[model samples]
Target chain A: MKIGIIGGTGDIGKGLSLRISDKHEIILGSREAAKACEAADATVCTLRDRNCTGLCHGASNEEAVRDADIVVISLPFQHVAPTLAGINPTYLENKIVISPVNPMGKKDGYFFFDRPEEGSAALAIQKMLPASAKLVTAFNNIAAHKWTLLDEELDYTVAVCGDDAEAKKVVMQLVSEVSRLQAVDAGPLAVAGIVESITPLVLNIAKFNGLKDVGVHFG
Target chain B: MKIGIIGGTGDIGKGLSLRISDKHEIILGSREAAKACEAADATVCTLRDRNCTGLCHGASNEEAVRDADIVVISLPFQHVAPTLAGINPTYLENKIVISPVNPMGKKDGYFFFDRPEEGSAALAIQKMLPASAKLVTAFNNIAAHKWTLLDEELDYTVAVCGDDAEAKKVVMQLVSEVSRLQAVDAGPLAVAGIVESITPLVLNIAKFNGLKDVGVHFG
Candidate 1:
C-alpha cells in the first residue's frame, strides 16, 4: 500500500516511516518538500543502519496526497485545518484519510482534552473533507517518543473508529501490521472523541506519576 | 477505614465488599435494607469459603452514608440523581465520596459515552452533593463481570481524578490496595469525562473484537 503522511517531518511520521517503510511504500510529505526529503533520507539511513531497506520518498503535501491509496494527517490539532485547507479537496475525495490528531491543552501543569464544538477532532476534521472521504481515527493514543524508539516494540492496543466499515477494517489491518499493535473496532466516528481523549489522559498520567511516555493497552 | 457502598446489591458493590472487607469494615447499602443484608451475608459467606474473614454489614442507603468515613456510589448513572435526592444531604457532608459510575448508552450494537450536560457523571454528581463533600472518580473503567470473579487478579491501571488533593490521595491509596491495581492521578474533576468515557470504549472493543470483559492498562 502507498501511505502518504502529511507533515512527515515530525517524530511520528519519521517513526512510522522507519517501522513501516520496509513493508509498504511511504510517501513522507511536508509543507517544505526539501525538508521532507531530508527527513525521508534520514529515515532511510536509520533503517539501513540495521541492515534493513526502507521504501520511503518525500514530496509536497498536495503531491503526496495526490499519489497514495491512504493518507495520514500527522499534523498537530491546531495545524490541521490550515494545512488541509491548503490541499486540494479533490485529492482527499474517496481516499481513506487517517487522523492521528488529538486536540489537547495544558493547564495548571496538567493536560486536558480541548474538545472542539463539533465534539472531537475527528468530527471537526470530517466536516473539512469531501463527503466521500473515509475518515478513520487510529493511532491517537501512542506516546510521541515511543514511536521513534525503534529498539522498543510498539506494543499497544489502538482503538479505531470510523463510519465506513470497509475503511475501518483496512485501517485496523494496517495497524495490526505495525510492531505488536493490536487494533480493536471502537465503533463509529460519532464516538471518536472517547478515543481521542485517551491521548491526553495518558499524557497526564505520565506527568503526575513521574512515568515516561505513557501508552494505553485495551486487553 | 469504614467504607460505605451506596448500591450494595450490584456486582461492583459486592466485589468491593468481598475484596476490601478483610482490611476495612464494609457497609453495603441498598434501597431495601433487607436486600443489602442478604447481599452482605452472601459476601461474608463467599469470603469465608475462601478461608478469609469479611467485616461486611448491610444498611439502608442513608444509614450507609451516615456510618462511613468514605462512600462509594456504585449506582447507574440515571439512578444516581434520584437515589441521592432520597438520602439526606447531611449524611454526605464532610465525607470522601467516590464515584465509579460511567454514563454510557448502547446503540447499533455498540456502546458510546452518553455525556451528561455537566460534562461527566463526576461533575454532574458533584453538583448534587453537599459543598463540603469531597468527590473523587476512580474505578470507572473496570469490566463489571471481572469484579465478581474471585480467582482473577485485577491487574489494571485505574485513573483517579478529583478537586481535593487530600481526598484524591486517599482514593489513590485505596485503589492501590485492590488486587494488582495500580492507581495514577489523572488530574482534576474537570477532565473526569475523558476517564469515564473509556468504559464504553472498552465495551465496544470487547464486543467488536470478540474479546471478553476488555480492560485498560495505561503503561
Candidate 2:
C-alpha cells in the first residue's frame, strides 16, 4: 500500500516511514519540500545503517495526498485545518484517511485533552474533507518517540475507529503489519474522543510517575 | 488499613474482598446486613478454597462507613446519590473514598460513556459526598470478572486520580498491593473523566473485536 503522511517530517512521520517502509511505500510530506526530502533521506540512511531495506521518498504535501491510497494526518491539532485546506479536496476524496492527531494543551505543568467543539479531532477533520472521504482514527495513543525505535517492538494496542467499516479494517490491517502492534476496533467515529483523550492521560501518567515514553495496551 | 465497600454484595465488592482481604481488613456492606454477611463469609470460603487466608466481615452500609479507615463506593452511577445519602455524612468525613463507578449506557447495541451534566461520574459523586470526604477515582477501567481469578494475575495498570494528594498516595499504595497492578497518578480530580471514560471505550472494544474480559495497561 502507498501511505502518504501529511506534516510527515515530524517525529511520528519519520518514525512511521522507517517502521513500515519495507512493507509499504512511505511518502513523507512537508510544506517545505526540501525539508521533507531531507527527513525521508535520513529514514533511508537510518534503516540502511541497521542493514534494513525500506521504500521511502519525499514529496510536497499536495503530491503526497494526491498519490497515496491512504493518507495520515500527523500534524498538531491547530495545524490540521490549514494544512489540509492547502491541498485540493479532490486529492482526498473517497480515500482512507487516518488521524493520529490529538488535541492537547498543557497548563500548570500538566496536560489536558483540548477537546474541540466538534467533539474530537477526527470529527473536525471529517468536515474538512470531501463527503466521500473515509476518516479513521488510529495511532493516537502511542508515544511518538517509540515509533522510530525499530529495535524495540511497538508492543502496544492501536484502537481504530471510523464510520466506514471497510476503511477501519484496512487501517487495522496496516496497524497489525507494524511490529507487535495489536489493533482493536473501538467502534465508530463518535467514540474517537475517548481514544484520543488517552494521549493526554498517558502524558500526565508519564509526568507524575517519572516514566518515559508512556504507551497504552488494551489487553 | 480497614477498607469498607459500600455495595458489598456486588461483583466488584466480592472481588475486592477476595483480592485484598489478606492485606487489609475487608468490610463488605450492603443495605441488607444479613446478605452482606453471607457475601463476606462466601469470600472467606472462596479464598480458603485456594488455601488463601483473607480477613473479611459483613455489615450494614452504615456500619461499614462508620467503621473503616478507607471506603470503596462500588455502586452503579444511578444508585450512588441515594446510597451515600442514606449513610450518615459524619461517618464519611475525611475518609479516603474510592469510586470505580462508570456512568455508562447502551444504545443501539453499543455502549457509551453516559457523561453526566457534572461532566463525569466522579465529579457528580464528589458533589454528593461530605466536604471533608476525599474522593479518589481508581479501578474504573479494569475488567470486573478478572478480579476474582486468583490463579491469573491481574496484570494491568490502574490510573489513580484525586484532588487530595495524601488520599491519592494512599490509594496508589493500595493499588500496587493488588496482583501485578501498577498504579500511576493521572493528575487531579478534573481528569477523572478521561480515566472513567475508558470503561465504555473498552466495552466497545470487547464487543467489536470479539474478545472477552478486556483490560487496560498504560506501559
Candidate 3:
C-alpha cells in the first residue's frame, strides 16, 4: 500500500517512514518539499544501517495526498486545520486518513488532554476533510522519543476508532504491520476522546514515575 | 496497615480482601453489617482452601472508617456521595483514601467516561473529604471480573494519581503487593481524569474486538 504523511518532517512521520517503508511505499510530505526530502533520506539511511531496504521519497503535502491510498495526518493538533486547508480537498476524498494527533497541554509539569469542542482530535479533523474521507484514530498514545529508535520494538496496543467499519479494519491491519503493535478496535469515532486522552495519562505516568518512553499495551 | 473497604460486599472489596488480607488487616465494611460479615467469611473460606491465611473481619461502614488507617472507597460513582455523606466525615480525616471509582455510562453497547464538572471523580471526591485526608486514584482500569478470579494473575500496570507525594508512594507500595500488578505514579490529582477514562476505553476495546476482561499495561 502507498502511505503519505502530511507532516513528514515531524518525528511520527519520519518514524513511520523508517518502520514501514520496507513493506509500503512512503511519501514523506511537508510544506517545504526540501525538508521532506531530507527527512526521507534520513529515514532511508537509518534503515539501511540496520541491513533493511526502505522505499520512501519526498513530496509536497498536496502531491502526497494526491497520490497515496492512505494518508496519515502527522501534524500537531493545532496545525492540522491549516495544513488540511492548504491541501486540495478533492485529493483526500474516499481515502483513508489516519490521525495520531492528540490535543494536550502541560500544567505544573503534568499533561492533560485539551479536548476540542467536537470531543476529540479525530472528530474535529473529520469536519475539516471532504465528506467522503474516512478518518481513523490510531497511534495517539505512543511516546515521541520511542518513534526514532529503530533498534527497539514498539510492543504496544493501538486502540483504533472510526465510524466506518471497513476503513477501521484496514487501519488495524496496517497498525499490526508495524513492530509488535497489536491493534484492537475501540468502537466508533465517538469513543476517540477516551483513546486520545490516554496519551496525556501515559505522559504523566512517565513524568511522575521517573520512567522514560512510556507506551500503552492492552491485554 | 489496617485497610478498610467502604463497600465491602462488592467485587473489588471481596477481591482486595482475598488478595491482600494476608499482608494487611482488611476491615470489610458494608451498609449491612451482616452482608459484610458474610463477604468476609467467604473471603477467609476461599483463602483458607488455597492454604492462604487471610486476616479479614466485617464491620459497619462507620466502624470500618473509624478503625482503619487507610480506606478504599469501593463503591460506584453514583453511590459514593451518598455513602460518604452517611458516614461521619471525621472518620476519614488524615486517612489515606483510595478511589477506584469510575464515572461512566453505556450507550448503544459502548461505554464512555461520564466526567464530572470537577474534572474527575478524584477531584470531586476531594471536595467531600476533610483537608487532611490524602486521596489517591488507583485500580480504576482493572476489570472487575478479573479481581475475583484467584487463579489469574493481574499482571497489569496501575496508574496511581494523587496530589500528596508521600501518600502516592504508600499507595504504590500497596499496589505492588497484589498479584503481579505494577504501579506507576501518574502525576497529581489533576491528571486523574485521564487515568479514570481508561476504563471505558478498555471496555470499548473489549466489546468491539470480541475480547473479554481487557486490561491495560504501560511500558
Best by TM-score: 1
In candidate 2, stretches whose alpha carbon ends up further than 4 angstroms from where it belongs are none
Off by over 4 Å in 1: none
Error of 2 at A4 (Å): 1.1
Q: Which digits, one per residue and each the tens of the lDDT, describe model 1 over residues B22-90?
A: 988999999999999999999999988899998999999999999999999999999999999999999
Measured against the true two-chain complex, the DockQ scores of the candidates, in the order shown, are 0.89, 0.87, 0.87
Residue B109 in model 1: lDDT = 80
Winner by TM-score between candidate 3 and candidate 1: 1
Candidate 3: misplaced stretches above 4 Å? none
Q: For every candidate structure, what is the RMSD over all alpha carbons to the true structure, in angstroms?
A: 1.0, 1.4, 1.2
lDDT of 2 by residue, B1-219 (tens): 999999988877888888889899999999999999999999999989889999999999989999999999999999999998899999999999999999999887777788888878999999998899999999999888888777788888999999999999999999999888988999988889899989999999999989988889997
Residues A1-219, candidate 1, lDDT per residue (tens digit)? 999999988877898899999899999999999999999999999988999998999999998899889999999889999999999999999999999999999988888899999999999999999999999999999999888999999999999999999999999999998999999899899899999999999988988889998999999
- Candidate order by DockQ, decreasing, is 1, 2, 3
lDDT of all the models against the reference? Answer: 0.93, 0.92, 0.92
* Number of the top-ranking candidate, with lDDT as the measure: 1
In model 3 chain A, which range of ten residues has the least summed lDDT?
A202-211
Question: What level of docking quality does candidate 3 show?
Answer: high
